[model samples]
Target: MKIIGIITSPRKEGNTAWIVNKILEGAKERGAETQVWYFGDLDIQPCRGCWGCHKGDRGCVIKDDMQKLNDAIDHANAIVFGSPIYMMQMSAQAKIFIDRMFARFSPRYSPYFKAENAAQKKLILAFNQGNPDSGLFQSYIDYTKHMFELLEFEVKEVPVVTGMRNGPAHEREDLRTLLKDIGSSLVGE
Candidate 1:
């Protein structure tokens, strides 16, 4: 099996990346091929609202690293999205990435609305917030779930680490163990 992890944080090796890597470690242990894509490192352009991809070939018109990202997502058996909440929502990077996925789906009124591979992808959605209370970010998480569902991804785990700004996540054994356990469970031991 192949698993792709997409990190949407501007900060490298930050809380977001750390959590994704920990999950990848578990998948790796199960002999799953794993890769991580840092959105900040890629030159992804915003969707232009063109319906070109919905035509014959079904490919995006904008040319950039998004082609590579799309290829990765197309082949992966599972995907993990990691991002830190910003202003009560997912980071701009994450939102842009999701928006770009418009190429993967045709208009709802169209005859070919859903892709053939739709509903075949298993997804893990993770988030890190600065607030001590993670409950405040439930709306953000729910919104993310809705977006992934629109993409036809079966969301599984949503490991959230809250109040990390007050204390480094490395010092929080509870959070560390939670991430590791979630990772192990992803591949079913």
Candidate 2:
């Protein structure tokens, strides 16, 4: 199965990114082809309120890079989304990406979702916070989980890494272990 890993941290190499790469490593070990997107590198425009995308053959009249991203998501068998926690919410980059999925809400194009059978690709969410108190991030996490469920993704359990406030935090053995399990599960699915 093809698995797409989306890293939403602006840091070139931050705690969130480190965890995502580790997951990719684990996913690769499981023989799944992988594509990783450094979200910070992209010029992802926010979804406008235009109803054009819902208007017939023309989808997402904004006409930016979102279409290609959507196509990739449609093609993938599984998805792993990793984002840094900002004010107890996902980073702006990740939020915009999720909002752009408004194009998918309408059945303008087929194959992304089989509404009849309710069959969909598996999805996993991974998040990280610098603080050890992960409790604050729960509400945002649940919202993301709900978003995926509405999108027809059969969600795998969300695994988040917290207490990583700074670098060298990757040195922690627990981070390695948790990411390893979550990443491996992505593949075995």
Give TM-scores for every candidate, taking all chains together and pairing residue i with residue i. Answer: 0.91, 0.88
Alpha-carbon local distance difference test for all models: 0.82, 0.76
Of the candidates shown, which would achieve the greatest lDDT relative to the real structure?
1
Candidate 1 segments whose C-alpha is farther than 4 A from its true place: 109-113
Task: Put down candidate 2 lDDT per residue, 1-189, tens digits, no spaces.
Answer: 788888888985887778778877777888888888887777789878777767785877776677667777877888888888888788999889877777666443343555432247787788888788768778878978887787777888787777776545478887776776776787754
The candidate 2 region of ten consecutive residues with least summed lDDT is 109-118
In model 2, state the lDDT of residue 135: 84
Query: For model 1, how does the per-residue alpha-carbon lDDT over 1-189 read when each residue is reduced to its tens digit?
Result: 888999999887788888888888878877788999997799998888777878788488999998999889889888989999899888998888877887777567243246665455888898989998969979768877876777778788888888888976667777666776676677752
Model 1 error, position 35 (Å): 0.7
How far residue 88's Cα lies from its native spot in candidate 2, in Å, is 1.4
- Model 1 clash number: 0
